[model samples]
Target: MLNLNGQTHRRLAEAMQQAMLIPEGDELVFVIGRGNESSNLEALETWVKESLDVLEDDLALAVLPLLLNRLGQTINHWSPV
Candidate 1:
């Protein structure tokens, strides 16, 4: 199991970023500590949805495990820590 409380968040984010096949100009927002995990994840999801309004693939996420469930079955960029 992954802890959402401490350094795990940072590590998860970094791992995801390193594994992503991102293009230039895409942004990966770190919203982990800005709010509660659920809220922050929702906000990030909303941001992704809004961003998709213009360009669907303009963002990447470096997310912790709790939030990983929110991303569902499409993710292929994660690595175990």
Candidate 2:
């Protein structure tokens, strides 16, 4: 897992809340495949970008790279079931 500071954690929480991607008081659970043709990352990027407003420009910029990097690592290590 990526080690995030408190402020970064809060910012991500706020972004997810604003995006309404996760229902209030609930958690998000999903899976992505390790296949080279998988479009999950692209879809996630588009979704996050579309969901953000002008006020979230910095949040998007800050979180996206970290998010993508973590996802890439996860994908790299994923073993097919």
Candidate 3:
């Protein structure tokens, strides 16, 4: 994992929130293969968690697997930080 400062983390959170606005089943290409140890992954996870706060209780759990699957592809290909 990358060691991000607070500013980097905040930027990532913002980017992720934006990513979540994409339609379901439509790949968030910008986020999908951006690599696991970068700002993008930090943003992706932050946005997902924050967005889940505004959704119906169970929707996040349902969507998380799909999110993780796409993210996993990138993680599998990542080099350690």
Residue by residue across 6-75, what tens digits does model 2's lDDT show?
4554565557556765444312313312233224433333334334444376767798999999998899
Model 2 CA deviation exceeding 4 Å by range: 1-54, 79-81
Q: Estimate, for each residue in 1-81, the C-alpha lDDT of model 3 and write its tens digit.
A: 234456765666566556666333324435543443344545355554445455545776787899999899889789586
How do all models score by TM-score?
0.26, 0.30, 0.27
How does each model score on lDDT? 0.41, 0.50, 0.56
Model 1 poorest 10 in a row by lDDT: 23-32
TM-score of 2: 0.30
What's model 3's overall lDDT? 0.56
* Most TM-score-accurate candidate: 2
Ranking by lDDT: 3, 2, 1
lDDT of candidate 1 over 1-81, digit per residue (tens): 222343444454445444664322323334423343344334344443344445522323334554677565446446343
Give each prediction's root-mean-square deviation over alpha carbons: 14.7, 16.9, 15.0
